[model samples]
Target: MKFDTTQLSQKTQTLSPYSRLPTPCSLLPLLKLYNKTISQIVKLWNH
Candidate 1:
């Protein structure tokens, strides 16, 4: 379950140079929204 930087870099290298990846800035909102949804789900299960 460890995060593997080498594996990530290898995958990225296989992509076309013109392909775009989401920057951290773009990912932040998605991460926040995902967290909020998980929190709500936990609350419902706890209820």
Candidate 2:
């Protein structure tokens, strides 16, 4: 599993231009919330 820049660029070509922009710091809270929800779902399923 290796990807060259050309391959990645080709793949991203179909996506919106904004998709190549750097991730914003505001996403950290959303990612934390998503992880917490997934952990809670896993805990419920384990029981």
Candidate 3:
């Protein structure tokens, strides 16, 4: 089977989260905050 580079590049662009977001670095802080919130909620639920 022959591989198409153009098709592969397009697929990569579509699949990449960095391409969809305006700032890739922004996701890290938001993810950390979300995790902290989730853990705090779980702790409260457990108590």
Q: Rate the local accuracy (lDDT) of all candidates.
A: 0.89, 0.85, 0.91
Candidate 3 regions with alpha-carbon error over 4 angstroms = 1-20
Candidates 1 and 3: which is better by lDDT? 3
- Count of backbone collisions in candidate 2: 0
Give a tens-digit lDDT track for model 2, residues 1-47. 77599978877785867766658687888899999999999999999
Model 1: residues with Cα > 4 Å off, grouped in runs: 1-18
Q: What CA RMSD would you report for each candidate?
A: 12.6, 11.0, 6.3
Predicted structure 2: lDDT: 0.85
Q: For each candidate, what TM-score against the reference? A: 0.60, 0.51, 0.52
| Overall local distance difference test of candidate 1 | 0.89
The candidate that wins on lDDT is: 3
Q: Candidate 3 at 37: error in angstroms?
A: 0.2
* lDDT value, residue 46 of candidate 1: 100
Clashes of 1: 0
lDDT of 3 by residue, 5-33 (tens): 99999999999997677675877899899
Best by TM-score: 1
